[model samples]
Target: MDDRSEGVIEPLPIRRLQESLINRIAAGEIIHRPASALKELLENCLDAGATSIRVTVKDGGLKLLQIQDNGCGIRRADLPILAERFTTSKLSTFSDLTRITTYGFRGEALASMSHVAHLSVVTKTKTETCAWKAHYLDGVLVAPKPGQTVEPKPCAGNDGTTIIIEDLFYNTPTRLSALRSPSEEYARILDVITKYAVHNPKVAFAGSPLPDLSTSSSSETSHAIRLLYGHSIAKDLLHSTFSSKKQDEAMEEESEVDDRESWKAEAHFTNANYQSKKMIFLLFINHRLVESSRMKRALEAVYSGVLPKGASPFIYLSLQINPRDVDVNVHPTKKEVHFLNEDGITDQISDTLQQALASQSHSRVFEYQTLLTGGIAEPEQSISKKRKGKERARDGDEDEDMENAETKTAASPPLKKTASQYKVRTSLQDRTLESMFPVINPTQIEGSSSGKGKPADISKSREIKESECYLTSVKTLRQNAIKGKHKQLTEILEKHTFVGIVDLNKCLSLIQHSTKLYLVNHGALAEELFYQLGLRQFGCFSRMKLQPPPPLRTLIEIAVELEETTAESGLTKPQIVDRIVETLVARREMLSEYFSFNITPTGLLESLPLLLRDYTPNLDKLPGLLMRLGPQVDWNSEKECFETFLRELAYFYVPGPLCSANPETEDQEAQDKAEKWQIQHVVFPALRRYVVAPKTLLDRDVVQIASLPDLYKVFERC
Candidate 1:
């Protein structure tokens, strides 16, 4: 006890860490690995408004890392403290942090690199006659060599910025040791660049000394993905655009600024046909490449139902959220970010993706019963022979006996099984009184002849029965569609009550049931109603006669030109055009009777359907509509023809884009308001009268408002 008291009498004194050591520690936090460091540097180039960014790396950027950008360069006056911590042109005050629009705002990337490595910059402003070169060590200017002046020197260079970093993490041996192999680091580097390339397809990326993995600046996102990823992933991609404007108005009203509350998300994802060993997720928030584990997991859950047990999908999403809603400083490296309503946004995006995948699956064409063809029979016979040989060996049968049995079977004529034999072999029973009747052979019937009389009568009966069955199936399917409509109507009438309009511009009306409010898409409702009305009023449509009765040849020519432009395999442009023209001409009378179109024999003038007199469609779309009808309509089936025709007509009745000219006078504003009021009062009432509620819209119950609670939850965040 005496020895302990003598040894531990004094406490160790506290002291400030040396600047070099402090800077090195901070640097280690920001640049954890080669990929993270490369991400920071790339962001800097984008922030500079560079159209093209070139990167060069040696030994996975541990030995040397360089980036050059053709953007606004650093001025000579700012060169001395260029690498200083907390220095940036993007932010002027602490308040700016709340709304950071730039990629690199904290000004830590360069400063951190300088502490762990030797940093140099060569920059020249557009107005500057000579470029200025500078060297930095630990956030301050230093000489390139010993005994040289510790100041920037004049040099010749392009009107841009060039940054060079050497010996990265040299002062932190532990961090250097923690890094992966150079090849692995290089792969990570490429992954980061590829994601950014997708986000900013207008920007070109080039690698020096390494493979020139560059993308064309003019390419679109799809093309860039094809170039970087591969054709396999690109071919199976499904695209969807989601916006917050699609949400209930009550949710959006909670935000102080309406415009700021609205956000848009675009996703390009692989369908069920495409799979990978691991999920390749590239997410960008406001064009800044970032990661969100919550988003990744949510998206993976969506694919879990679509893909095989051990497979995943490729997803690239770009989200544009208001600056104030996003906290970019949550992580030191800014590799991840926290945004307002993270859970709500993620759920919405995941739901949208799932809906897209479901739709894609529904559109797939399956080849059923193809194995019944002769081409498949050969393989089946071979497999059966192999199985029989194995069975004989297992049973210890002699090969000679097996050969003799096969030869006997081959020599004998094949036996035709009678109807009684078929009935005895099958377990299925007709559960009706008809099952009690004995099977009668057609050849043995009363009017039977030795040759053709009974056989001809049996063939005629079978054909008549098949035709009846086919017609019955068609009738059943149509009845099912009608039943579905009736079921939706019953649910809506029983469960929901009409509420006031929320947004007439978007045709969104709020309806409440119990404590929840649902946003109804009146636009979609109107389209469905118009289609139903057309079907009900077939062959008696009201006509909107053209003033001068335009030449039908003109419409035919337009269709021909469109067909030529979008021609597909197995059909020549001229052949498609000729077929379309001939088909329309042949069906002219039928079109006139059913659709109220009046055309002359020599291809002249037609009247269109007068759906809603107040709503005028964009006449410019008429030719394209006719062109699609030629190919999309099923001419072979009467049911499909009617359904497709009604759908096209409904599409034609939908409203077009509003004029965007400035409404400078009160009269113009009043007229706009009056139009919206008319839509709400006249159009919506008429639509509700005819339109039955749909089972689903965008993977959600159309009339029930099942997700109304989720909408309320989103507003709570606001």
Candidate 2:
């Protein structure tokens, strides 16, 4: 007590209680949560150039925390000052903070964390043959059990640093109660990893709610996340390059990175899309993981126009900069910082993104969907028929959710059935490498009927003209059939000799042809061949135009439709009077885009547009050309469909520049001559524009045939 109480006031001696109280308050600021402490310790390990990092947590970090890194370790001589306040090997003075390069420089994380928790460090540097270890409490070395040395002891360890924190805020009830459940905390931990993982793809980062996966209980397997979740997590990163650059703004003394910045980072978030719904994108301006609501909002905004509505994305951005511009003193925990030029950076990021998307001219996210009809290689007709029947029965011929559909049961029960009744679901050809990728869904196909026509038999389904296709397999198939006493496999093959088919519902029967498989569809199959064009790639569909005397690409699309789809069924006949009206009505816009199109209208296609009417040529063909609405796209409420109709089919088909294999060179030539083919013919005029409450995404079938392996077995072993 240095206080003197006489006539004048005198200074009092500093009380020990006051010093202890101040230390505890400071502890609250630095070690806000288990994650905060973990982050700080992790950064220190990384700054040491550690190749591997391991983290373990318990009871949402109320019980224990541990982190080990294979980086430079503290020396035994430094152990006494290891947990002391204001002691660090990073920066020595105030000016050093400006050009700071390492992750930690304030020298407060260790001291502050030590004040509220039991802390320990087991470390070994390359200089000493032996390792060193220490323990601390209230930022000071503690005597082990009352009589042990407070200094480090020689111990065995690798060249690394290991930190442990236990009973965080043991004396603070409010802080302990404020922590979330173990599972919830783990989610937050994974969330943090996801952001960092996206940014630091080369750094292998792994963490588990349990200490180790091998030691996890069987019950824990029930909660085992998808492989995508773990990969997207910052656990097993390798090397990755990012073309991210920062721009400075002299105005307002602010600098920002706009979306215009070109970036091609192969991140875990992109791969994680296959496993998890929440996809993440990371940006590292430098090394610090700063929070930029602008970056986050930009990501969400870009995704808003692309992904299904109502879905959000996850991201973590790390910006490395000299510490001077960053005010690390802003937050007690220091998990966040105030950057000097946040606004400037946001603008650059957003601008870069806008340019990137605009440059991708043909994104192909939307296309027609329909199964092609084709003969499969070595068709096991009886067995395949049986399996198909079982598949239909199990699915109940209705749309279902894909998520709830895939179960993770280790083994499925066996079914009891006679051998004669069994069948294999997939063919040997289907197990090929190319088949491993999922097949795109085909669009609905419309038959040549203005009204909903009745189901037809083999003969009626063959609605084509003899002049169009002399190669109808149906006309020549019966002769190849063999008459045998037993059910002959040859007989079945002879009946359906085409290689593959893309039907209305988008089904495919791929055929084996040497190492490569051929998908023989009646339409578009001939047009899908690879042809090199400028930077834009043009497949099967021809991109060139022909007018003076000969036409090439249009004839190919026309010929293939008759050859594949209706080898048994004939092609639709052209309509007469009404057809002329369609072509004559519209001609202007088609000339500018220089694209080809055809229409098979059902009603008065001729009345709708003169340009379309001209293509039909026959009175009956007019009805066939009238638009018909089949199933909606069900993904975008058919917006793309409507856009396609307006942009491509509104005008009559005028052959544009015949798309040569060289599209880049041909594009220039074709554009100059585009005026020659404008409004020549309507490509697919029968697609109706109006709809009543088009199907929402929820209304979609969401069918994932491969998702139900067990259920598929019923069909496989029919």
Candidate 3:
């Protein structure tokens, strides 16, 4: 053996880490960057019920980071141990963790910041006459100067909280070195504030030298998007709400104790026409901003087929799930979260987004294209040439005018040299194209006529029989089942007598039947009725004829414009538009007979479905309807296509709120009351007689008065 090997190896002694060193190690996990520290401070401000939050930064927060909020401030007595680990007002016992609804818990954020940076707080609660200020370091209150006391001192301030952090990650050279430039860090800070502003639009946010962000207390999500993201995004955004309920009654009954299993997801996403180089994803779970790579990837996959290569979309999704179903403690910083039914929820959200995108894309109006007079000849000429060439090749058939051109020119008088004489005319073999595009008179030719051809009649009506109307698909079956479950409500509706209108604003009505008083949701009843009416009158819907019907070319042009805006590779924009126009033109007979769309071959909309005699279908949305017909309707299977078409028709016929430009005015109010009376006497009774009632109205009991007993009991106590 070597002499060095002969020496005995000594065991190293075990020792506890110094308090400062231990704190620094913990700080590394929580305060990874200046943005991370700022996020924690912002969360604290929000938890204090701050309505206004102000942030200040210097050198990308590496030198200075400060946040002030006008909210209920911290108690002076709590300052001493405010930075202590695991000290929090949000939770007390272990069981309280499961029901935590606030953002900042564990009380580790401030403690971690104190260890890595200089931390100070100035706060004044409503009860306090003066503010109390304190400095902290390593989880303990510290003196600001050499001779100052190590305790909170009374100071002048507003009734809110202000937290200041300086020299973030000062104790960790490696972490400090890992950070990017100050401007980059500030960018990150702005991004966090932007997302939070979107989530809590009621709260105002300001950072000096940067534009202030604020919204009305009652502002919607779209308002926030317009204020923060810009009008471009707001204009193109499509919104939807999704919910999941237990399909099996047994499963629902077994989980009655924790009935919070249901979840709702809301999404605001850009359409296919709106594209970016990279996807912008904002995800909030239970109002907490979090990152889920799995969800991001799933959503991104949905847009892959819709967008061109390297193009992406902006998506903002907020999910309200039960606290018990989410694991918010997976990371120290809580930047990433894990949740139950991740894959299933992700798929549902993705599918919903895809459908919304398709619908939105099909509804876009391309304002640039001229409907009839301009650029219309190119597509028609191309189609006519192809048809003519094919017909001649197959049967040597030619138009009468073409075959007798010499004889007609020799026999006919000299044509008038007017501007109209130079106008070009197009001819088709049958009424399909003629209905979409009509032709003007021309010189008659006798011998050149093709005996095999029939005269094109654009005004002829085609009828769809009742047997052709009752088409059902899997989706239709499921919908019917859901509607059928409300048998008890349907019976009640059949027997009920319309009493009067209770709340016009809420569409609530009062009805009496079988010696019982009941409150009804007239809006829900109207929807159910409209759907049933659509099924019963599927093939021969009443028609609302438009006077001087709008040009069909206008609708086709709008569809073409939408397709061009959302153009992709492999198919040119014009080609896509042509395909859509062709499909709609081909289905003209089916559309007219079943949906009451009497469109002329020369691009004229003759009529539409008249669900209500006084209510006219919004013509502005007609282009969108025509555009969607080519994509959303299933043409491969007649049953599926008809089912989808009827569903869309029913949705279109659902009653809309009466228009009130100045609802606050007395005249408007009076008008609204009159309208309500009309609906109560005329609409409600009609609906009750014909429409089926849904089992649940707004997720409440539809027919049964279970809550009525509780009301009576409360009245007795009163």
lDDT of 3 at 141: 96
User: For residues 191-283, could you state the per-residue lDDT of candidate 3 as single tens digits?
Assistant: 888888888876667664243343433356777887677644776788898878656889878865344567889999988777789888999
Error of 3 at 194 (Å): 0.5
**Across residues 1-718, which tens digit of lDDT does each residue of candidate 2 receive?**
4335545676679756776677788778777777778778878887877655667778776688888766778877788888877789988878886666776877778888788888988898766798877889988888656788787767776667889888888878888788878777766665555444434444445553432221111112111221223422322222223335433347325655453333332222221122225545555544666555566786567656544656544443344544456666566555566656666656654555445444543232432222222112233344466666665566553424542565746587643332222333335233433224463452222332334432122232222121222333322221121121113211222232223323222323333322122332211111111000100111112223222322222322243333222211112323222222343224323322222332223211112222221122222222222221111111122333332232222211322222223434644534322221111112111111110111110111111112122233456656
> What pairs collide in candidate 3?
435-600, 435-601, 435-602, 436-601, 436-602, 436-603, 437-601, 437-602, 552-603
> In angstroms, how far off is 383's CA in candidate 2?
22
TM-score of each: 0.50, 0.45, 0.50
lDDT of each: 0.69, 0.44, 0.68
Estimate, for each residue in 613-660, the C-alpha lDDT of model 1 and write its tens digit. 344555766776666567555564677677667777786665433335
**Candidates 2 and 3, the one with greater lDDT:** 3
Q: What is the lDDT of candidate 3?
A: 0.68
Better of 1 and 2 by TM-score: 1
**Model 2 spans with C-alpha error above 4 angstroms:** 1-17, 207-283, 314-325, 361-718
Candidate 1 has its poorest 10 consecutive residues by lDDT at 368-377
